[model samples]
Target: MTAGNNGTNPPEGDDPFGYLYRSENGAPSAQGQQANSPRRSYNEVRAVGDRRYGQQQRPQPDQSPSPYYAAPETQPGGGQGGSGGPGRRAAGRANQEPARRNGLLIGALAVVGAVILGVGAAFAFSDSDDDKAGADPGASESADAGQDDAPDPDDGPPEEDEERPLPQENGSSLRLENGPVVAGDVEGSRAKDGSYIHGFKEGSAALWQPEIEEDGEYTVFVGYTVPGKDMSLQVSANDASPYSARFSNYAGAEEGDWAKGWTQTFAWVELKKGTNDIRIACGDKAEQCSVAMDRIWLEKGHVKK
Candidate 1:
């Protein structure tokens, strides 16, 4: 048989390395040929051994996946096309610089994008706040006005009503000469209804009986006519010393006009309660009253005139 058909030959003894070229039955190879088969090459056997060893080896979890180059002196070179020399270290440094630069660039881009997004968010928030405030501007002002109009809790109590002045009280009134005759030269006038008392000669006197209830200050007023020179009168209460005084009027024109009436307020006087005696008489002066007295009464807050 030809050398190409040698698979049909018998086995050679004492050939330990000959098993790859010829099996026991001399079967054809997977390429469908029984032609000349040599032992596997050194490179092929080594490649196969490396694959099997790699499968059995454990992976290091801390190994950096992308550090593509490293110096053999520090760490074995892991980059592409690395020669088994110090040139591997130079190539490793060159490739590492570019990788670091790329990493920084990516980080810078991420920061810039974050800044841009933050600025946009800030602007959006500010615009939303402005819109809300502008939606009802006058509402805030009205609320302020309402607060101003509200009454203050600190204000004091309401003012009390003012007290009014007391009303004036009056005592009884009587014709002057109609007072009980008390040792005087006073005479009844011919005037109508005992309207007057006349002839108050010097030292002449008459009295008034007042129905008083308490001992207090009172006012005495007299209505009279003086047509001659000013006439003076002595007024007394209970015949007391300091309780007596003289009152005079200058309302005279002449003796012929003695009938014209006038009124004079005699000063405040004090009276003992109940049925007090009040006297009026011509003055100590010899030429004292020819004056006529008409009405007499008592009131408060008056003075002799």
Candidate 2:
């Protein structure tokens, strides 16, 4: 205080500015202290710079953007960053969750539908096989039923209004002819020339065998021609007792024109299973006995046992 402090001075108490000084001499003033102070290190200066500029020292190129500083805002649930708006993250999750769920549901439905279709196809194939397996038996049963219901084929010949004669050949023996034979041993018999006869026989007879297992009705037809003679013919089987009838009355041939054709109708006869002989005899010993017999034929009828 005497002549005005010149170079340095000391504070009165422990001064707040003491941290900036060294105790090398009396307390230096502001300008003198600055000249004597040590220089700051590069690291220290860089740290201070970083703090002031809000930057890091040598930040890596690959470093992620800071959540608080990069872009507009960050998602609340830690997804892609977006505008700093309310419910941004929630809205993102809401949009994506339904798609994921829908995908999952679709996948599940596809699997379920595939299983259902597979099961249905298996069932259909099984049903088809079952139907195929059963069809054979059904068809066989139907065939058997049809066979049982069908009519027997052993029925007799059909009926006709007019009786027809069977044609005879040279091989047929035991033929009956009218009197006055054309060129046989009996040509000059008691009958007139070319007249009819009564008891006529042939040189050969036809053989017949019956089916005994299936007994049935049979009809025998005998064809004859007569001339002006009302005659009756009798037929006997195996030389048994004869059954006689006047064919003139039955065939409506009684008009006395005997040269016309005549037919003898007989009842249905049952045949046995052996050889049989059929014999014909004339009924009347009348005038000019002359007749011609053609042939005999057998026919089977219904009513089989």
Compute the lDDT of residue 5 as modeled in candidate 2: 35
Runs with alpha carbons beyond 4 Å of true place in candidate 1: 1-194, 242-252, 301-305
Q: lDDT scores for all predictions?
A: 0.55, 0.48
RMSD of 2: 12.5
> What lDDT, from 0 to 1, does candidate 1 have?
0.55
Lowest-sum lDDT 10-residue window in model 1: 166-175
List where candidate 2 sits over 4 angstroms from the true fold. Answer: 1-95, 115-221, 232-234, 239-261, 267-271, 281-289, 294-305
Per-model TM-score, in order, reads 0.35, 0.43
lDDT of 2 by residue, 174-289 (tens): 44434323332323222223332234333222232323323345555654555445555555665457666444434444455444444444434555554445555553443323
Clashing pairs in 1: 184-205, 227-254
Worst lDDT run of 10 residues, candidate 2, spans 183-192
